[model samples]
Target: MSGILSEDALDTLFRHARTHNAWQDKPVSDETLYKLYDLMKWGPTSANCSAARIVFVKSKEAKEKLKPALSAGNLEKTMAAPVTAIIGYDVEFYERLPELFPHAPEAKTWFNWSKEWAEQTAFRNGSLQGGYFILAARALGLDCGPMSGFDMKKVDEAFFAGTTVKVNFLCNLGYGNPDGLFGRSPRLPFADVCQIV
Candidate 1:
C-alpha cells in the first residue's frame, strides 16, 4: 500500500488526466462534493493550517452571480459546467490553529506576527490543497477544469464578501466531453526542468 502505484492509477491521476474546458450535461451531487473534501483534506499543509475554502457554484442563480467576474474567454465553458468551484484562502486561517494544531497551541500565534506572513502561508498551503482537489476529483471518476481566468477581486466580492477569504483560482467539475478536448502539448524534458545533486 506504500509503493509506487500501478500505471493505470498513475495515468488516472496524471499522464492521461487533462484540464477540461467542455463538459457533459451532468450534475455533481452534494454527496460527491463532501466526499471530495474528505479525501483532499488529508493532503499535507504546513503545520496543518489547512487554509483552503471552497464555494461550489452549481445553481443557475449561483452561476449568474459568478458570471460578471469571469473573463470573456472563460465565460462559456464555466457557465456550461455542472459546478464551478471558487477556491479561496482565508487570511484569518491561523485563528483556528489553536484547535487544528493543538499539540502545539502556540502555533496560532506564529502567523499573527504580520499580515504578509499569514497571507503568504495561506496562499501557499491553500494552493496545495487546490492541487489535491484536482487529483482527488480525477481519482473519483470526475474530470477537472482548473482555471485562473477570472477577476479575483470581483469573485471575492461576489462570493466572499464580509469574510477574510480571497479567491485563489476556479475549477469546473463534471464529466468532460471528449469532443472538446484539445491536443496534448509537450512538457519539459527531465534535464530541462530537473537536476540531480
Candidate 2:
C-alpha cells in the first residue's frame, strides 16, 4: 500500500490501456465480475456514500433490452462485447450512510440540507467509483471501452426504472482485438494543465 508500482504495472493500469472497439470471443466469468467489484469497492468516496451501482448486461435478453438506448457508434461494439456495465448514481445514497459510514449515523441527515446538493454529491462520488471500476478491470487483464454516447433517459428507463439509481455511463468489457486499435491520441502535458504555489 506504500510502495510505487513497477513500470509494467503502471502501463497495465494506464499507459497501455485503450478504449477498444473490437473484442476477442472471450467471456468474462461471473466470478471475475464479483472479484472486480470486491476490489473496486474500497476506493474512497465522500462520507463513504458509496453511491455507484452497476448492472452488467451479458445475456442476449439483457443486451436486447439495452440496445435501443445505445448511440449509432456504440451499438455494434456494445452488442458484441462480453459485458456492458451500466454504472449509475443513487440519489438517495444517504439512506445507507448508517452502515457505510458507521460511527456517524447523523451523516444520513445531512442530505436533508438540500436535495440538489445530495444529487450533486452522489453524481460526483459515483463518477469517482466508475473511474475505479475501469482501473480495476485493466488490472485484471480486461480491456475497457467506456463511452458516454447513449441516450441517458432510455438507459435509465430500461435498467433503473422504479429505482433510486440513474445511469451515468456505459463501458464495454472484454479481451480487446488489437487489430481494431487506432493510433494513440496525444495528451496535454502536466505543465499545461497543472499549477504550483
Candidate 3:
C-alpha cells in the first residue's frame, strides 16, 4: 500500500515503455492483464464516474474480425500482438452517479436529462482513462502500441454493437521487439512549452 517504486524505477518505467511495433510471439497472460487493470482502475476520474471499458481481443477469430477495420500499416502488427484492447466509454455512465456520488442526489438527474451532456462527459473522461491505461500497462512491464489508425464505426459495429460502450481507441500489448522501434522522437522543452505566471 505504501510507496513501492523508487524515483529511478518510476522514471525507468516511463522511458522504457515506448510504442513497440513488433512482438516476440509471447503472450500476455490473463493474470498479468488482470493485474494491469487492478492498477489502472484506481486512477482518478471526474466524480468517480469510472466509465472506461476495455475489451481485450485475444482470440484469432476476434482479431480476424478487426483486421479489415485497421489501416494497412497497423493490421499485421495488431494481429501479431498478444492482445488488442478496445478502449471505450459508456455513454450512460451517469446512471451510476447516484451511487458514485451519494452525497449529491441531483448529480445523476443532471446528466440523465440531457443525452448531449452525457455523451460529452463520457468522451472527455473516457479519453483521460485511456491515457491512464497506457501508463499503467507500461508500469506493469508490458509494451504498448497505441494507435488511431482504424475505422471507428466499423470497430464499434463489429465489437460493440448493442452496447452503450463506444470505442475511443485501440492498443496492442505484449513484449516489445526492440528491433522494430524507430529512433526516439523529440519533445518540446519545458521552458518552451510552459510559462510561469
> TM-score for all predictions?
0.98, 0.98, 0.93
Q: lDDT tens digits, residues 29-83, model 3? A: 9999899899988888878888898999999999999998999999989999999
lDDT per residue as tens, model 1, 47-116: 9999999999999999999999999989999999999999999999999998889999799789988999
lDDT of each: 0.95, 0.95, 0.89
lDDT of 2: 0.95
* Model 1: lDDT of residue 137: 94
Cα deviation of 50, candidate 1, in Å? 0.2
lDDT of 3: 0.89
User: After superposition on all CA atoms, what RMSD does each candidate show versus the true structure?
Assistant: 0.8, 0.7, 1.8
